[model samples]
Target chain A: MDSRKKEGQMKTNDILEKKSTRRSFMKKLSIAAAAGSAGLVTGGCVGGSGSTEEMGLKWEEYFKKNYRMMTDKEKDETVARLEKLAKLQDDANIQMSNQEPREKVLFGYAFNISRCKGYMDCVEACVQENNLDRNSKTQYIRIFEMDSGQQDPTSGDGKYHHEVPVENKYYMGIQCFHCENAPCIKACPTKATWREPDGIVVVDYDWCIGCRYCMAACPFWGRRFNWGEPEVPKEELNPKQHYLGNRKRMKGVMEKCTFCVQRTRQGKLPACAEACPTGSRVFGNLLDPDSEIRYVLKHKKVFRFKEELGTDPKFWYFMD
Target chain B: MKKIFLRSGLFCLCFVPGAVFLAGLPAMASGGGVMERIHHAEEPYDSMAIETAYQQPVKTVRAKESWQGGTFRVLTRKDSITRFRCSVCHTDKKVLVKDGALFTHDDIVMNHGKGENGLVCIQCHDEDNRDFLSDSSGKKIDFDHSYQLCGQCHFRQKRDWLGGAHGKRDAYWAGERVVRNCTSCHSPHSPAFKTKMPETYSLPLDQ
Candidate 1:
């Protein structure tokens, strides 16, 4: 009875402390805001930022909440700011939409080990489709050529440029696996990274502090860090972009494949899958048991690169 | 970092849409029905979004292959090279044309079906009808459905192809699934994928 009484008192005391702090914050907010604004105004009058409106916008942008936490009004304001800035900087009028995940539509991928010829057609297609940084040599998809009787990824070389379909050799391609237990998301100190409803791990480029911790966490070497200012030529930029995806990424941020969120969410096959001449890559909805991915899993001897690690990757590979 | 990611997004949005609109201007201005091509570009997205019968992919058909006397060329469905129809030369008499001395198909070069595999032209091609292909059972098959002719001996590959385990699917991931014909990717004669250079965006090394 004494212990329960003590616990109840402690709970009430904790509530009281929270309430007192909140009350104090409310009480001092307007006064402090007014003082700060007045000080800025006076300073501006005596030679400060020529336009207070620009100053206010900068403040609003800096203080905006996380992408997932923002209210509808906040989202609109932020979008407008982005549009105005894009226009001012690049003279481009782009539409970056936030597409919600479709209901019962979890994405998965599969690749035929026997079919891939290391043609690298998928890599070229991905770069063209995603508007990757041309100057940074940013390539999302890499086709690795393996020797005779070898299926291990570590032994494969993506940089091989010789005439392909080498005798007794095979090829396989790698990209973001979109694991169910994403280590990259967990490694982020800020809440800048998260998995979407469709299980695509995404980073809020705007919110990221560029700490590079997430890069260290990924075992698949999935995420790429922007070490230099990305320089995509004006003519090469793809205008169709999703806010969380292939939108023009900023310097010092991290980015990975979202399974072509802008295209796939609208029901188009990802560029890599579409460009494959040999049809090595197979993609479909995991929720739908009738999907081709499920068929490959059930009928073929499918294996993943890192199954023993317990990441539960949605991507699978099989050879006939 | 006290940095600005939105400011960058703003920059991106500004330039990207403007760039797209500029590209669209040329596309819109082109004469002689450029609209159809533009429509075709958007077809994958539109067709994929259409609510239709989710046909579980894969369909089985028997396959067959025939010998041609010339170079390995994937026999196409158009059959544009055919000069004369079956009725043009073939008639009531069971006669060999030109006394069986290199009278027709002078370009054909048979590299496959050697020794025990040595096959006569009529083995798969209909003896009486030039247009119709024949199976081992002497089943008269349409030239348009020649995949059935190739399936006669390659029954295992045919099974794999029909199960969506061995072939390519169409670009549109959902909706109607259209698979490529065997001859589209493979030469009917050689039946082996040719080695080629990998497509490169930019080489990392000069070598």
Candidate 2:
């Protein structure tokens, strides 16, 4: 862990060096442009009287290094900038977390197929907790209502609107599995997505180049791309945010479930698990032999979704 | 010769279960059931075997039932109950709702058991002592620990709940292993869940 952090610092220094060189070049260009367009500059200065601070913050954010490559100081600065931006735009005070994953803790999930009654309480909780885009209806978790004979979740219907737990049917939820050998990481051209030490696969949203390659490469259909500006109502916004998990995203970037890193990193259950009315979901440290997840894995007749794909997903499904 | 024989015996004893344990792991990872083998290789069922390992401190109430072995903490129940202290109205006598004498529990419809001869209020509730519930043998049980009454017939769910597979747990995963009691999700009178519309449904194209 120490060596990995050191490597991150070294990479950050390299990026900082490059950023300074780029900054000088941009500065020269801006100076030349300003000199060339003196009349326009005076008009812009007059027109943008109270917006210089916001522009400066945006400029710094554009030049910020990737989350994984940032030093402690840089991380703090970025978080503060985001908080300031939130206050400026929405007038909503939000606390964004950059809490690192805990040691010796590999988070895993277990879903009891028989128990889920298809009420979709978890879907509601996840959308609210993550401050998902309201207009587009971006949801991290999808509960599929599977027929009695069919075991495959993909074959089931996720758009069922009528009264749920329809006779002769069961429900199974699917989300980002946070696979051990995540193909999305390999597909990323910019190294935006990577698995943390504690087994959570997270995307550094700023670094994602809107390529959508990770989305294509993911077998589980786990990644979601922002085609337009993601919007959340001011009152419904989840003020507690995480850099890699649930922080607001701009247009053209990709986002997925991060197991509620903002909450889970603080030892809380993911919002979906906590909101499950039927007690179908279980989340815990896989490393802990005595965890409820471990107990389920040990005793229950369990199977991973798409185990044949060799993704080695941390999520499992079991029947009572 | 004696020492060699003892070493061989010890190795055989250790290696047999160790081999079985290692074999069970891949089966678990691959999503296969080798439960019969696991039972043979490990110690007998102990409900309290799992230990709590959390970074943050958690608030929990100790379960009072012997089936739980007091291994885990359950979330506090009494505070959440809307009409606690059943003895408030029935002081020392059976208080029956005659006609329309301002009934407090008029909306409670008992749909728990099957058929016309299904579970009645007196079967689970003590008429003489409204403060407590009665089990099959008519043992007085506090309302807070109502699982003891529910578990009498639904032993399978009780077992799964004890093993952490059937019931809902507290918000935090790491902290003191606190779990919700049976009554938290299920109404004691009508345990079965009613069908309801989903809170939010995503676009079909998004899937």
lDDT of each: 0.67, 0.78
Which residue window of length 10 is worst by lDDT in model 1 chain B? B66-75
Q: Write the per-residue lDDT of candidate 1 for residues A144-231, one digit (tens) a residue.
A: 7778677666677777778888878888777888876567776887668876656577878887888988878877777777877787
lDDT of 2 by residue, A42-118 (tens): 66678974466665677678768778768999999999999998888668899998987776567889999988988
Residue A68 alpha-carbon offset, candidate 2, angstroms? 1.1
Query: What is the docking quality class of candidate 1?
Result: incorrect
Taking all chains together, each candidate's TM-score versus the true structure is 0.69, 0.80
After superposing candidate 1 on the true structure, give the runs of residues whose Cα lies further than 4 Å from its correct spot.
A1-64, A71-88, A93-95, B1-132, B140-144, B201-207
In model 1, state the lDDT of residue B149: 83
By summed lDDT, the worst window of 10 consecutive residues in model 2 chain A runs over A1-10
Tens digit of per-residue lDDT, candidate 1, span B1-207: 234787887899899999988975532332112112222322122233545324333342323432111111122453533554666556665657666554455566655565689666787779878778799999997765666887788777666666566666555556554555676566566566678898973232111
